[model samples]
Target: MATAVVGGRLESELVRDGSDRTKGLSRRTVLGTIAWSSLLSACTSPMTSSGETPAANALATPAAGQTLGSGSVRIALIIPASANGNAGAIATGLRNAADLALREFKGADLQILIKDDRGTPEGARAAAGEAIQEGARLILGPLFAPSVSAAAGVARPAGVPIIAFSTDTSVAERGVYLLSFLPQSDVERIVSFAGMRGRHAIAALLPANGYGTVVEAALQKYASASNSRVITIQRYQLDRVSMQVQAEAILPVLQRKEADTLLLPDAGDAAPFLAQYLASKNIRQGDIQILGSGQWDDPRILAEPALRGAWYPGPDRAAYSAFAARYQAAFGAPPVRTASLGYDAVSLAAGLAARYGQQAFTAQTIANPNGFLGVDGAFRFLPDGINQRGLAVYEVGTGTATQIDPAPRTFSRTM
Candidate 1:
């Protein structure tokens, strides 16, 4: 029955309303119960001691969100939850993940305010404004790149830190951290691996878009660092026709054998066709080692016979499979690959908030060099707010992909 005003609009319209926003007596009872159960775990937590630093093993269990308490930290989750698009399913998975984290960890004092960004920048801006006005200390969402940019415009000035889901490095800066699996990281890993394996000369046939441009730049950067060279770079429009044309354009280079490795980072079923077209040009996998980006992790890519022996960089599937099993048991459905992002973000916020209190969201603490171990692997936030994840290299095999290299369990001092 209480109405809150934000930006001349009723807060109820922007933030969540109705019985979903539970607090007060019910919250207190839950907290009291969890407090008794996790008293030992709380005391033993790395967050409890100033000298003790959290390691990969410390993050293995729910540390901070496990017990309910007062002076709750309000977190705003801005994602597309409406019924109109595919995001509804993803949003359900994300919400389910956050709920599961809370239930398992005892996040009684953590109040999650869900807001629908409607998959638009304007909607994201409005939702962010509502979040800040409603006392949200941290914002977690606005999945798309444009939406993240729009939401950041509002939250940054309000001094609210955002952990967005977009992989766009261009949108990440200062307080707006991106939790998505960046292409640059994938490129760096796979390229470095290739260079170490004696496939130094790299050539990429990338799509003509922002993602492709980033991949190309990443290839150049990582290649130079790894004592490798980017032989040639070709761009395509990312359609069937354009793929064929680009494949043909790069055929001459392939024939000349100037490049030892070929990078095809397209998503969906494009990799098959590109490989098929290149094979038609008498270019076999034996002549040049094929490489893919994280996007090629899809199981559908395994069906492509030409992609056999192709290498790609991606999250440790073993770690993800464990989380997926837990998610399915909780939600009665499989979560999208990105569902961990939401869970990790909320859990991190809850843990840090409980650990450092008001100083949890500051740049100093959030970008700890030790990093945080996530469901996928160990990841750290850089000063620029780009998350660097430790990923593994996968080799496409007969009807499957196997991890050729395991993702590092702990953060290396240099990396």
Candidate 2:
């Protein structure tokens, strides 16, 4: 069941002087008295997080001599320390969202603490401890699976819950909850859509990496469950030479009528190269529909003429125009995948906190079945803490992304 909290009431008191005012007090005396009165008033007034009046559900004011200023609530944001990686971008996005949330709840007196894990397990553990020592009640991230594992050891015992950004479901346990966009879900959606379109036989050109391996496994599992056939699966190193060799090797398979669908698990950066190779083989877009992961949202993919009609699953950008505009105004660039995810994560946490108070940081709260609505769309947490997203499918056309598939709905058993 979801947890709930009650908001505290504000009280006002007036102070009076015992002395008679038959003769008006001197200017100096009046000034001194006013200064002291103002100070006393400030001391008695309740403190707030965002500097606004408290909401109906705001936490009660702490007793006298307790932690000053509405009892500090710290949130640790553990992310890669590097400033140039995807993880880094996600971290920045989370921070930005948190800042916005804090601004909205100024009266709550919420304190958001941040820590960098440098994308290492050891660093994550150290950062988690530091946040605890600094009195953090909740943790926001450790963007990698290994980092989540390392931080979980420290956070679980303290009863501090974590909203991690790791994609690996295995890392979720105890008080840790994942807030990532799992590639498996994206693949499943793509495959199911392809199957519905009567494109059964499948082939893949994936990188020889952990992500690639996961995609391969997911494809096999979905194909079996969906009663589809996998005609060929090709692996390629990310380097130029290996990509060329792998493309050439797959050309023969592409010639087969059975291999009517091709899945590329790589991101947008690799699209142009793959498109060039596919064009050389005279494989037009409509002849064999190309399926891709959400990573294809990168603008670079649109530059490739051969990528037209290429389909991939991703969040609906049209629904978040305000967020996109504000983000661009602040960061001087449009929102990318990382930025959108980050905004959603922060908004989710803020909503949870507003609802649950102390219970907001609990594992059960993070994994609440109802889940949280985000800027991207509605998403729910599985038992393992990975977010089950309902993503939208888009097609590349004329150097732009166009929505082709209908918006996803909550998966009901009856459906």
Candidate 3:
């Protein structure tokens, strides 16, 4: 029925890339592919030496929200932990993850005051107001786009920055950062990779939805940079017959080989159906390379056989694998893909607070062009509040994704 505050952990070292850390590995210093350090296995209670830090569980928040940590620099983590459906589970799991991140980091420069938005915009606004009132220097999450917008309405005027978990690009701007994976990155990575392989022209079968719209816009925007142009586009509803119709419509383009690559931006059965439809039409195995977005990171999509050589872009698989193992060991359960967002947000807060002092949450400090590498490889906040990550290109094999390109250790340009 009310907001709650608790105190929590901090990592002492600068964020490191698992693929690039030269000092080798140590349990005390690990935050990369290994996911966590020995803190989870070694420390039973979170230790904040300042003696003023609140107990880890001082109170319960509205709905199923939880609060963790207590220190001078307080940050708020707003999530829909009590919402209906799988959202509650995902939020709670990730909520615990924020706690785990600070615990593993080994210091206590920050306290996370968590609030539950109950998956509603109004709730998010109220939560943000409470967090700012409680002296929180930063805000993290509300999960969905509407919630992010609502929270931003309150945080923006108060001069508090937000690091949201939504994948929607529309919610990104100025002081609000999206920490989730964006499909546009997939578009850029895959399209550019294909261009290098001598594939310059592209054909696409996009869904008639927002996801499709975002990918399409990215294709157009990155055309000049990637040296790849869209030759044809067929937008279809997400149904078997609709996909077949679109496949048929795009068949002529494929037959002419006008487009060297075909993009199927939808996941689940969409990619499989479209690819199989083309195969049924007697298209040669190597007639065109099928391109996909990060949505294709599913096992069923990878093992669908029809999409054997399809390529997609996503976070570094190796680092995530290692992070998942350590997460399971620390919490006794595996984490969802988005759990990295929560962990990284808290780790970012800690890393900044430790080094930047009171200036930790400033826009200039958070948007470092070099970016910061976490359990999910490297990512940095753009000035526009959207984020870009160092994603790897993966080629789908039999029930596996072969990493064709490693994620960049650092960002290339300061966009």
Candidate 4:
């Protein structure tokens, strides 16, 4: 039998002595003796129950002969499989962050486990079950909204906390905490900043998807809250022809209404085409200031001349330069944007483990008011498990992103 007191809790289990199961004292008695010995030592010793051994007190080492438990704290990194190219790259970056965190917090006995959700709800549920079976106390992903929702359902009952990478606020509930950079916060920050810069009239080109819808709503809300007006709202499919048509239609509205700012939320894959279409319309980049979400971090936007002077809100890239350098050195490539998300997630988990131990590594602790800070930014988890983050504004100038506002400030959300 083996006994240990971990995080101020007594745990005992019977074990065979080598190949001789019947030899020596009874396993239960041995375990009981070990527990009693530990408790007696605690009474006589000045050590804290949280495992903080005083540097000067050398006699308080090893809990006076009680052996440490062999159980490992499992952490799952759930992401879409290798099929989706962009998602795969993001997952690789997340894995790299996990590897880095393991090296940083080596004393926690943390064991990272990877689970591919395959970008499906069913796959997420199965992956979550596998993680639980392998004894995972914390989960770090399921990049997509549907998968995050499904994985949260499976982990909640088991008291495991999930640090999801999905930007959708709806998926953040129960035991799930969003660790991704959300577009709504970015929209609010950019709109408020632009408003402060005297850009009153705003127009938007959004995709016909849930994410785009959220961005559109956020733009409208923020515009009204900031005392700015949204002159035109145009929706477009991902197709080039559809985007061209929408861009042309919006160009006439912008010209007529004289809107100075054009907000575009869908900036991936469609950014270059949208930029080209806007350029063809003779709508110079300087004429109308382009406001974008964090999605504008893609390098493709930098290549477009029409995207110059575009402003967006995102994580502080400068703060993560060292992390990116180390990640690239180890993984042979720089981490994707979501890699910072993973690093933050692991840091959050390690902080919780250090502060509250294994028992405190639950859903409620993640939703604490004084939440953990990471490479991305300062975030506090709400009661609903959604992380509220402050976003910094970045401006694209001469094919480079310039930090206009290095610090994130509070904005009115009344509208």
Which pairs of residues collide in model 1? 65-105, 66-105, 66-106
Clash pairs, model 4 backbone: none
How much lDDT does candidate 3 score?
A: 0.71
Candidate 3, 1-415: lDDT as tens digits:
2111000000000101111111111112233312222221223333334433334343222343355766788999998767765556557656766876777666757788879888788889999999999898899997877888999999999999999887677778989998877777778888888887888899989887667777788898776687678898899986788889888999998998898899886866788888888999876447788888776777668888888888887776655665555555655566655666787788778877776788888999778766777766677788998887777788989988888876676666411
lDDT tens digits by residue: candidate 4, 1-415: 1122111111111111111011110001000011121211111122222544333312211111121223265677786654343555555667666655544443445566777776678888998998888788888887777787788888988888888876667777767877765666778788989998999899888887656777788888889889999998989876888888889889887777579988876655686678778877787678888888776766677666788888887766645665665455555565554566676676566555655666757556677654444555556677787666666777887667888876442222210
Looking at model 2, report the run of 10 residues with the lowest lDDT sum: 6-15
Predicted model with the maximum TM-score: 3
Q: Give the least accurate 10-residue stretch of model 1, judged by summed lDDT.
A: 22-31
The true-versus-predicted C-alpha distance at residue 126 of model 2, in Å, is: 2.7
Cα error, candidate 4, residue 30 (Å): 43
Candidate 2: lDDT of 249? 82
- TM-score, one value per model: 0.80, 0.74, 0.85, 0.73
Instruction: Give all candidates' CA lDDT scores.
Output: 0.69, 0.61, 0.71, 0.63
lDDT of 3 at 342: 82
Model 2 bad stretches (over 4 Å)? 1-73, 80-90, 105-109, 168-170, 328-337, 413-415
lDDT of 1 by residue, 211-280 (tens): 6777888888889998998888889885889888888888888999998899988776778889988988
> Candidate 4: which stretches are off by over 4 Å?
1-73, 80-89, 116-120, 272-282, 362-364, 409-415
Positional deviation of 224 in candidate 1, in angstroms?
1.2
Cα deviation in Å at residue 317, candidate 2?
Answer: 0.4
Report clashes for each candidate as comma-separated counts.
3, 11, 8, 0
User: What value of lDDT does candidate 4 attain over all alpha carbons?
Assistant: 0.63
